[model samples]
Structure formats: C-alpha cells, structure tokens
Target chain A: MKYLLLALLPVVTQASEITTQRQEELIYLLHQDCGSCHGMTLKGGLGPALLPDILQNKPVEFLTATILFGRSGTPMPPWSFMLTESEAEWLAVYLKNPKHDEK
Target chain B: MLSLSLFAVEPRGTGDMGIVIERANGSILIIETTHNSQLYRVEGLGDLSHASAVFSRDERYAYVFGRDGGLSKIDILAGTLVKRVIQAGNSIGGAISQDGKIVAVSNYEPGGVKLFDSANLELLADVPAQYADNKQSKTVGLVDLPNQHFIYSLFEGNQIWLLDAHNPKQPVIRKFTDIGLQPYDAMVSNNGRFYIAGLFGEEGLALLDLWQLDKGVQQILPEYGKDDPKKPVYKMPHLEGWALTDDYALFPAVGHNEVLVADRHTWNLVKKIPVHGQPVFVIARPDGHQVWVNFAMPNNDTIQIIDTLNLTVIATKKPGKGVLHMEFTPRGEAVWLSVRDEDKIQIYGTEDGQLRAELPALKPSGIFFTARAHQSGL
Candidate 1:
C-alpha cells in the first residue's frame, strides 16, 4: 500500500503542477504558435493536422515526444526548451480530445 | 433636407482604405488610413487562416486569398463581398499582373497556379506544379512580373517556374529545375527586377534576374550562418516582407537570431545584424530611411527598428505579444502593427516611436493597405 501511494504521489504532483493559468497559456501556444504551421483550426497547412480524428493513430506518448523533441527532418522544431515533459504530455492529451471547435 | 441628405452618397476615394484580416474568424475589417478607423467588419470569408490580399489597379477591389482556397473579391467602397469562389482545396497566397487584368493564386493541395479575370473573378487559366512521377508539388511564392508573367517556387519538386500568362488560357511556362531544396517562399524586388526564393531545406537563397532569364538562377549566400549551430526555427520567415534599398537588401536568416544584409548590386553578404529572436518580417518603410523587424514565437512580443544608413538597430519596442505583421502608410509617416494576442492594432509614429493610436480587433494577422496596389511584389 505504501509503494502504491508513493507511485500515485508523483502522478498527483505532476498533474497538480500545471496550474489553470499555465493551462491557458499552453492552450494559447497550441492555437497560435503550433497553429502557425498546423492550421489555426488544426485542419492542416505546412504541417499536418493535430485534430483528434487525424491524431488518433498517434499515441499520447508518441505525440508528447514529438512535441518535445520535434520531427528532425521536418519544419516542426523542438519545444523542450519552452515546454516541460509533463506540459507537453498535457498538450498531447488535450490535442487528442475531440472537444475543440473548428473556430 | 435631412431625409434628402441621408440618401445622398458621400464622395470618397479608396486610396486611403485598406483591409485588416481577422485570421481566427473568416472576416476582414475595412479600414481607412486617413482616419485610422474601422469603416466596416465584412465577414463570411471562408478559412482565412493563412490569408493574403492583392488589390486591383483601381484600389477599389481587394482579391483575398484564403487557406481554404477561397478567392474572395471584396468591394472596399461598398464594404461588401462582391464575389467568392473555391478555386482549390488549399491555397497559400496570390498575385496580380502588371496590367492588373490577371489574378493568379498558388495552391498546396492539388498544387498549381490558377489565373483569374480580376474584373469578375472568372477562371482564365490553370497551371499545375507537376514534377517527377506526376506528383504535384506545393506551389508557393507566387508573384507578378512586368508583362503578365507570374513566377512561383515548388516545395517538393525543388524548382521555380516562370509562367507567361500573356496568353491566359494557354500560358507559356519556363521551368528552372534543381534550384535548391524546398523553396518555401519568394519575393520580387521593389523594382520587380529580381526574384529571390528563400530555401527552407538549406542555408542559401535562389536569385533570379527577371531581365536576364538567359543567366538562369543564381545561388547567393550559400554558406552564410554555416558556422553557427543549427537552432530550431519557431516560425518560418516570410520573404514577402524582405527589405530592399538602393544600396542593400535585408533578409531574415533562417534558424539564426540574425538578419542578413547584402549588397543590392553584388548580392554579397555585407553584414549580419544580431536581432532579438528568429526574425520573421524584415520590412522597410516606404521612404527607406528605417527598417522595422518583428520576431516569431517566444520573442514575438518585441519589434526592433534598424537605421538603414548605419545598419544598426536604432531602437527596440515591445508592442505587446503576437505582433504578426506591420504596414507603413503610403509615404511611411506612421507604421501600423497587429498585436494578435492582445486583440488590438497599435499605430506608432515611425520617427518618434510614440504610440499614436489603438483600435480593437480580433486576432489580426496581416494589415494591407491600398498603397500596395501600386507596388509590384507587396
């Protein structure tokens, strides 16, 4: 039980670390910065779409790694400098959800 | 008398009028420079996500190119959408001909350049960006030449094609192959003599002399910033905003925090001005006395002004976040900047660096003026 609690402790802390304000900033970055290459509506442009339907095949971990490390040959640059590992993970999860409106 | 005067039309000229793109929404704000105020918020332009505008010779009609391949003809005088057509699946931008008769759009999905009658938005010609194995390359950097000629670069095919639409329906094409890898965007010089394409996959720029087509395309600054370690580019630098003076031409160095200044005649690297961030738009004021530059991504909140005579950064100003674009008035007296994140348009005096006015907007991206009607590669 103590080991399980320790394991859950890290997860709880990690999830709580992303404040509501930081979440808003991340969403803004997703829509504006990432939206620059990927279409503002996430439909697709120079970069591929980040929509839930299109990104369903990509796992959360895979998308998180791509967000942090970036695709090497492509124009997508790494965001590890600005984004934390968990923040990128959160963005990947948010992108995979189908709640975003086209607008 | 009041009822009679209400129906009477106020005579006005469209030379002072311009369009500001509300990129998030498919709408445009019809604005006038004389008053620096919004005249109308014209909506229903589809998917203006990455839109650009080209004005007709009369400065009355604006040909708006949208990301969803929407070609909208806006009547600025009446503040209405005159006509619209889905010309392609996905499009980047467009250009108007020297005679202002032809309007050509560059596409990405089923990549090609479509020529239209600027008068009624009628299709005149279709030129595909076909390369090896019948694979269509994404066409970009479409700009007008002096004689109904349109030049554009291919991304996947790595080539630049010059289209002579003098005979609209059956246009003549001159292909320049193996120019470089991934010619992302291009621009014609202010005088329309030189067309330079910024290569995304490499460190050089491909230059074509419009007068000497026989000379072919030349690679300039192939080894610039070669010594510096490659930094990740947050946003692609727009060559459309490249600055050119009588003595020099200024371009944003990709993946580096520097702006490359080259001799206009020699095309040789003259100096590299280290800037605040990865430079996006390095634009010069109309008078050519000072150059204004904005950055991409995290450093986007700041704008740096460079003195053309000294080649030194004269001043740096923080004009709020998401400073997507800047446009100077016809004679360069004042410059207008679009602060996208703050949802406002900030106008500053070019000489004083003082805030002149502020107007409300919704996620503005590009601020274009009617003055571009007279310029070649706006």
Candidate 2:
C-alpha cells in the first residue's frame, strides 16, 4: 500500500538541489525579474505563460533550452550567461511542477 | 552618517508628490518628494505590472495607467482614489493632453487608443487600430502632442497615427503607414518638436517631426546595427526613459551594453559608449549635464552615470540586485533610485554618488514625481 501510494503521488521533482542562495535568486529572477513581461505570477503578458499546465505537453529539456538560448524573433532573451545548464535544467523541472512551492 | 543638510527638503505645502509603483502587490506608495518619504499607500491598484503615472497640471491629480487597462485618478493631497476605471483587457501606457483636459490610453488587447474625459474618466472616443486588410494591430509608443492631438504607433501594422481631438467628439485621424516595422517605444522631445520611434523589426528608428508631419517619416541611424551581428536582446528598451542632453541624445542600444549618442540638430549618430549591460533608462539630469543609466535583468544591479560633455561613463554604482528606475529631484541635486531586490529606494547625491538616504518600499519599479507636471515627454 505504501509503494502504491508513493507511485500514485504526483511527480513534483527537481533535477538537482538548488542552494538556498541560488533558489532565492532563481525565485526573484522568475517572479520579479521575469515578471516584467511574463506577468508577476508567470501567467502571461507580452510573452506567453510559463505555467506548468500551459507547458505540460512540452519536455523539460525544451524549457531548459528555451531559458538558456531564448526564442529568436521574440522578446525572450537568452540567459546562458547568467544561468548554468544544470541550474536551467533544475528550473525547467521546477517550472513543470511549480505548484510544489506555494506562493 | 550621510549629512541631513545635503538632503532635499520639501518646501512646506509645495504639493511636490510622486507615486512609486509596487508591482508585486499592485499597490503604489504615494511619496512627498521634497521630504523624500512615503505619505500613504493605496493597495489593490489592479495590475500595475509595467505601470506608469502622469500628474495633472496642478500636480494634485494623478492618472495611474496599469497593464490590465486600469485608469485610476488619485488625489495627491488627500491620498484618496478619485475614481478607478478598467477600460480594456491589456494596456501599455497613456498620455494626458497638453491642455490636461483629455486622457488617452494605449491598448494591446483590442489594439487601439481610447480617449476619455480627464475630469470623470468618461469614454470620449474609441479609435480602432485597423491595418493590413481586416487586422487589428496592437498600438504602442503613444504620446500626447500639443493642439489636442494624440499620437501613437501600430506595432503589428508598422504605422503611426495622429488623432486630432480638438472637438473631443468628432476627431480626425492621420496615418503614416511607412514609418517602420515593430516600433516599440517612442518619445517626444522635451521641446515637443521631434518624435522619435525605436524599431524592433529593423535595425534603425523612425523619426517624425510634429512640425514637419507633412514630410512623412524620416529614418535616422538607419545602419545602427545592420553590418554588425546583433547580440541577444534581453528586454526591449523603452525610449520614453531615454535622455536628451543639451545638443546630444543618449539612447540605449538595442540588445547591447551601449548607449548611442547622437547630435540632436544634425540627427546623426556620433558615438556609442560601452556600459555594464543592456541599457534600459539613460535619463539625463534635469540640468542636462550628466546622464544616469540602468541596465536590464541580470546586470540591473549597477547604474552608470555618463558625462554629457566628454561622453564617458563617469561613475558606476551597484545599489542592489535589480535597480529598476530612477527619478531626480526637481533641481537634480539628489536622485531617487528604485532598488527592487533590496526593497528600498536610495537617494544618491547626483554629483558625488553618495548614498543620501534609503526609504523602504515593497518591490517598486517606476517612480514619478509631481514635478513632472511642469515638464514635457514624461
């Protein structure tokens, strides 16, 4: 029953542990920094929404790639200089299941 | 301790007030600028995400424009909401007429400009932004011109429109269809002569002369980035916050850590000064001597002060993680900067760059003073 319950639990996972400092930076980058165009809550604005449900069909790798390289011909700018591949990977996973952290 | 003598003191009852937008909670901190302190807070201001406010000529009435198409008029003295109206689903910003009789809001949702009665927030006219065969384009880069005319750019359609609201009922509209593609932000000169539009779809910007509107749009810096490989553009720069010095204009270069200096009279590029990061606001001091510039995300921590005469980054300071906006005192003695991550607004000496005083705020972005009432192109 424990295994079954564990298997049935929603998958809210991160690729790696983000340090408290790094996590705080990412939260600010996601909430307040990215909030300028992506909406304060990551819903939608000049750019599209970054909500998990909105990006549910997309792969975590795609989200990480988008954050790293940014979409061309769009307002989304590359953050490869500011974020590492691993950190972006973590953000991708967190974004996919962002509800894990309640605002 | 910073000397209190250097601080700007509010001349008693001058009504020198401003609104600081706290985007996180959709609230604004009404501050008395002369005192450099908060007077009151108006909460639940409705989608202040990328918001702006313009003061009525009397400096008593404030027209707060929100991203969620909210138009709110608040009395600065009473710190009370005069009236709040949500005119559209999404909006960029707005402009109040020179005469201060009409208020125009620029929209992105339905793609048009709406004129309202400045007194009561009544819808005066709804001009649709239709272009390119049955398509409604998002309108942006809007500004109020003299003679009761409201001017704006059509983002998707690549055109500029001017609305004459002299009658306030039946308005005549003029369209400049060949201005440029994707004109993001525009600004009218402090003298209200030149209207320059920054383009994203192309390399250069489109220039319009309100005095020479009959000549159509003229292109300047037409080859700004055509030969060079463009860097990654983090956030599109808004020209509204750019600076215009005595004979030169300092504009943030698109997608690069550079400020493009141009000769105002000749309307030609002079030089590009490399800065810390992608420039956002390159606002000149009221004296038109030194210019202060802020950067876009990741590098937004530092602000570079540029010397207008020598054209060099004279001073650089990192106030906090995200330095959003800055507003100078009417005399340009002390400048107030909104340090977003630190949740504090720092008043720095414009000359020595000394930390004067810090006022606590809640995730602030834009800061506008009531003194804007006496200025142009706010």
Candidate 3:
C-alpha cells in the first residue's frame, strides 16, 4: 500500500507542473501580442474590454474562432496565420476562465 | 504695437494643442487634444465649451460640433450651453457663414455637408456631395463663401463641392471639375472674388474664379523640380499663408515652400517666395506687412517668417514638432500654433518669432481667434 501511494504522488506533481507552465505561456502571449489594441490587463484599449469573469460563460470554441477568424466589419483583423490552432485553443480556455488556478 | 504672451503647460513631453474660445461670460476654454483629454478654462475668457463658436457676422454665440455628431449652441455673454441641435453625421470639418447665421459641417460616413442654423443648432439641410468615383468619402476641409454658400473637400473622392445655403432646405450643389488630384481644402478670398483649393496629389494650387465658375478653374503654377513627384502634394491652398487685406491676396505654397503673391484684381500668380518644409498654415499680422507661416518640420519644429512686401522668407523660429495649424489673436498680438505630433500649442511673438509660451499635450486639429472688435459686440 505504501509503495503504491508514493508512485501516485509523483504523477500528480508532474501534471500540476505542466499546467503551471502552460498558464505562464498563455499570459505572456496575451501581454505581448494583444496589449497594443486590448489593454495589457485586457480591460480595454482601442478594442473592447475582455475581462475574465465577463467572458467566463462564453464558449471556448467560439472564442478561439473569433481570435483566429477575427470580427468582420470592425477594426479586428484575423490572426489565423499568426497563432497555431492549439495555441488559439489554449488562449480561448484562458480567456474563458481567466481566474482559474490564480498564481 | 503687437505683444506676445506665452502660456506653457508645466511638463513638456505631451503632444498636440486643442483650444476653444469660451462662450460663458468670463472664461476661456482650452483642451489638450491628446489620448488622455484635459480641459482648461481661461480666467477672464469665459467657458469656451459652452459657447457656440461660429465666426458669424454677429459674433454672439459659439457653435460646437462634437466628434459623435452632437451640435450645441452656447451664448457668449451668458456662458451657458443654450441649445442642443439635431444630430448629424460625424463632423471632421466645419465652417460658419460670413453672416454667421449658418453653420456647415463636412460629414465622414454619409460623405456630405450638413448645414445648421447657427443661433439654434437646428438642422437646416443635408446636401449630398457627388464623387467622381464610387468611393467612400471623408469630408476633410470646409470653407465659408459669400452669398450663403460654402465649399467642402472630400478625402476619397478627391473633389470639391460648392453648396448654396440660400434656402437651407434645398442646397444647390456645384461641382468644380478637374480642380486637382485630391482637393483637400478650399478658401474664398475676403472680397469673395477668388477661391483657391489645395491638392494632395498635385504640386500647386487650384484657383477657381467664383465670379465665373463656368470658366475652367485655374491650376496655379507649381514650383517643384520635375523629378520629385513623391513629395506629398500641398494639402491645402492658402496653407502657405493668407492675410485679410482689401488690396492684395497672399497665399503660401508647400511644394515650393514659398508664398505665392497673386494680383487680387487679375487672379494671377505674380510671384513666389521660398519657405521651409510643408508650411501648414499662415496668419497675417494686423500690420498686414508680414504673414506668419507655420512650417511643418520632419526632423525639427520651426515657424518661417515671410515678408509679405517682398514675398520672401525673413526668419525661422523652432517651435516644436508638427506645427500643423495656427491662430492669430484678434488683436494680432500673439499667434497660437498647434504642434500636433508634440501635442501642444506654442504661442509665439508675431513680430520677432520668439517662443512666448507653450501648452503641451494638446491633440489640436484646428485653431481660431476671435477678433477683439467682435468680442466687444462691434
């Protein structure tokens, strides 16, 4: 029983470490790329405000699509080429639950 | 005798100068045309924002055109916003009638001119402009003409439209063909005889004979070297400079960087005097012998002084970046220049070209000064 518990603890630690790394990467990307139009905090700039709680109920898939395809008839231009599909998906997840696992 | 007083904002690095004359009884209105807008009131000048700032013949009210298409009327003596008129299209350019009864604004999206009753900010009429091509139009420049008429310049269409506001409900539109590649601005001489328009694609001025619109509009001679076509064309005529005098008409040319002296009677480009880079706007001193040219500099900021008598540049003073527009006090004691990129208004001595004061971080696009006589209810 003791040996089995030790093995499980190592596996749990590794998963948490990976999750932390991904969160850091997502925040860095948003600050660098989106800060110009959207405020660094994503409050608002030339673009509309995008607070975490306000967007929490929004579908992650829809958020990814908007980021990749962009809103037509507005100043938002498409960023499909700039971001990979997986990266866009991660951003969507982060935006939808911005306060998740707060550091 | 002319004197200069400088009003410098404490911290220097802010850009652009946005200033307005107050309509309230005892204060002046000044705003910084920056991303972060700041508002100021002149102690004795009255509340500028409350005044309907139309330069009408009567000079009683201020006509305020908001960016969101809100027009307001302010009573000068009462220092209060008197009325709010019907909303119009987005206004980037505006002008008041010579008689001061009408206000005209150049709308952006709908791409036309909207005339408003100056006293009430009431919608007089909407005159749709005709474009040579099916292009989205941005009305960039407007000038008031004599006889209840006004001229508007379009950004996309690159044309000029003359609107007759004689009947506010039905405005007659007269299009001047082949005025220039892109007509950015138009100015009618005080006498109402000659109208000069500026081109963004050409190197010279477009001279229109108001008396004879049927005759071909005259393309005033250009002063650029044939090889340099890419140098941005003169964006506005009389941009080089214009002084209100009964006898002679003076204009500045950006391409040649010189003031073009024209015979008011004959409407001929009699001579040209060389000036500095991109002379944005000019103000004639009350003496009428010297017209101040705000020279827009790429590397440095400076104002070029021109001797109206000889049509030559006499001196240059460094004011700061992006000296795009200027206003002379009605008394001609000081000249207020909008240093756009720097976001400040630099006040200068009209006689010696000295920096008297600087108002930093104003995103000012236009500047105007009310004549003292007009203020005195003359």
Candidate 4:
C-alpha cells in the first residue's frame, strides 16, 4: 500500500509542476507584449495602467475579449491574431491571480 | 546695379529684402522683406532646413544662413539661387553688416566666428574664439555692433568678444570676460545703446552697456534666495528667446513657461508673464506694443501674441507644427514663419493673424527680409 501511494504522489506532483510552468509562461508574455503600451510593469504609459486590484477579480471571458478587440479611440490595436484563444485565456487567469509574489 | 532675378516661383512683387521661409515639404519661399512681393520657391537639401539669417541690402541679392552652415545667395527676381556656399562648421546663428559687405557666422563648435565677404564669398578673416585656459570655447552669438565691430558670445568660456571689422584682412578683438554661463545668443537694440546677452544654463540676461564694460551693466534676473544657489533667479528656464526694443528687453524662459520683461534703462525685471510651452524665439513688432513668440514643440505648434503693455499673452495662434523662427516684413503687413516639423513656410496676415497661404516642403530654418528696391537682374 505504501509503495502504491509513493508512485501516485510523483505523478500528481509532476502534473502540478507542468501546470505552474504554463501559467508563468503566460504571465511573462502578457508583461512583455501588453506591458509596452499599458506600462512595463502593467502600470500604464500610452494606455491606461492595469492595477491588480482592478483586474484581479474581473471575469476571464471579459478580459480575453478586451485583449482580442482593443479599446477604441486609443493606441491599443487588436491582438486577436497574435494570441490564440488558449493563450488569451491563460492571460485572463494570470490577471485574476496577479499576486504570485505574495506568500 | 539693381537687378531682378525671378525664379519661376510667385513673387508678390512688393518689398526689397525677400523673406525666406523653409516649409514642411523641404522647399523654401522667398518673399519680399518689406512688402508682400512675389514668393520665390527654392529646392532644399536636408531632412529639415531653416533659414537662420537673411542678408541683402537690395532685393536683387539675398544670402540665407542654414543650421548646417549651408549658405545660399538667391536672386529675388529670377527666383533662382546664384551660388551655394558650404563652409565647415555648424552655424548657431549669424548677422550681416548694414552695407551688406561683411557676413558674420557664429559657430557652435570651438571654431570662432568667420567673417566672409558677402559678394565674392571670400574669407575676409577668421577670428579664433577658442579659450586658452579651457579647450571648449564654443561661439554662440554674433551681432554687428557700432564702429564696424562684431560682438560674439563665447558660450563655454562665458565671455563676449568685440571684434573690430574696420579692416577685414586683420580683425582686432576686444574681450569682455566673465559675463555668465553659456552666453548663447544676443541682440543689439534699434538704438544700439545696450547689448542683450542670452545666457543658457544660467539665471538672468546679462545686460552689457556698450559704453562701459568695467562696471558690468545690470543683470536683469528673477528674484532668487541669496542662500539657495539651486533656486532659479529668474525662472525663464532655458535661455531660448532674447529680444529688445528701445525701452525693454524680453527673455523667454523655456523651462519655466514665462517671459521676463526688463527695463532697458534700469536693467531690472519689470514683469514676468506666463506663456506657452518652450518659447524659442520672440520678435518685437515695429509698434513695440506687442511681441510675437514662436512656441517650439514637436506637436501642437503655435505662436503666442504677448501684449507688451500689459506684459501678458493676449492670444495664441496655431499656425502649424514645429514653428521655429519668425520674421515680419519691414512694412509689417505679413509675418513669415519657418515651420520645421511640417516642412513648410506659413504666411500670416499681421493685422488679424489669419493664415493667408501655405507654401509646402521647404526645409527652411533661418529667415530674413530685404527692403531694397528690386532690380531687373543680378
């Protein structure tokens, strides 16, 4: 019974590690591309600053839609073709849990 | 012999010293300095060209000074240029003698001011403006003083040199030391009683009495705490625009967004009026009741009209983007402005500040007007 439990633990931990790595990759992408005009640290420059408090609780679908179709009358252009649906969803999830640094 | 050289461009056919306006399209418009005459369009060679100074006693001949030291002599009537003179230096600014005999060019480099014969393009004399103690003596301002002498502002050394131009072969230097920091630009008033020195990176304009150099004339500066060295004395931030009338001297502060008006007699700050962004050049109208300021910016270009009597901005006109330098015809009917970023020369009616016409694509940087009568041909 103990050997069986040990085998199951390794499989579980490996799956969780992969999922965390994917999330981190999405966060890095959002910071690099979206952060340019929106503010490097996602604060804001030519575009409105994106705060964690304001965006963290936002709906995933709403965030994804806004990224695909940029705000009008502003410099933000539509990035629908640049990011896949999955990639956009990943960013939405990352925005929700923006406090990765928080213990 | 007065001659007319009309280059296919339109000539309003009014004044003598034609105003040169470099347009946004990299073309130049040459209009009469005194009257609204035919506008001559000339081809230019540069990303953005400005006619810094224009020299011509008669309308038949006009010499234009550019930022990169590209000088061209244009025939007003024919509307075609006669010759192109390219010297080795960057000309910050320059002035021509009253007789149109000598042209003094100021260099931003350590190389001193160069005096050239206007007609033949001969180097009459090259006065070395380098400082012996320091290697960085950049000459910034050049103006014609009384007695055929030229006053040059040495920026790095913070001094002024009065050069005797009586003999073009050998020039004599009269040095006025320790004026201020970065003496960038200067101007001699209509009466020639005072020389207003625009000092960059320093507080106040250095008012030098042409008659007495020993007792430094009053420095028209803003009030600053004696103990606080960092506090600006007169917050006319960047020493960009310096102009003078018979009664007052106007210094525009680029950083502080204000214009400091000083009494020409007392050399004291009479008033400080708020103005637009980065006022680069100020021109006193012949009436002296108002002064026109060209606000320098990459975008949102405009000209601020200051009511000199009240010492305040009466109005602002958005002519175009990148309005660099401006000049009024001797007759004051039209005001020609060099639009650098737009690459065009814009003409405005002096009375109402209305856009009369737009000449596109002239890389004009510096400009001047000639009032002499037009001749048939050069």
The root-mean-square deviation over C-alpha atoms between each candidate and the true structure, in angstroms, is 3.9, 5.3, 12.9, 15.7
Model 3 interface RMSD, one decimal? 12.9
TM-score, model 4 to reference: 0.67
True contacts kept of each: 0.43, 0.37, 0.00, 0.00
By DockQ, is 2 or 3 better? 2
If ranked by DockQ, best first, what sequence of candidates would result?
A: 1, 2, 3, 4
TM-score of chain A of each: 0.81, 0.80, 0.69, 0.65
Sort the predicted structures by TM-score, highest score first.
Answer: 1, 2, 4, 3
lDDT (tens digit, per residue) of candidate 1 on B261-317: 999999999999999999999999987889999998889999999998989999999
Q: In candidate 3 chain B, where is summed lDDT lowest over 10 consecutive residues?
A: B44-53
Off by over 4 Å in 4: A1-103, B1-17, B21-27, B32-38, B44-50, B134-136, B214-218, B222-247, B298-300, B372-378
Model 2 compared with the native: what TM-score?
0.90
For every model shown, what is its TM-score relative to the native structure?
0.94, 0.90, 0.61, 0.67
Write model 4 residue lDDT over B30-65, tens digit each, in one string. Answer: 665433444567766221232354546654666666
- In model 3, the Cα lDDT at residue B196 comes to 70
How much RMSD separates candidate 1 from the native structure? 3.9
lDDT of 2 by residue, A1-103 (tens): 4234323433323433556578667877787767777777775556776888999999988988999999877768788988888778767776786654564
TM-score of chain B of 3: 0.73
Comparing 1 and 3 by DockQ, which wins?
1
Q: After superposition, how far is residue A47 of candidate 4 from its true place, in Å?
A: 32
The CA-based lDDT of model 3 is what? Answer: 0.57
Q: Give the TM-score of candidate 1.
A: 0.94
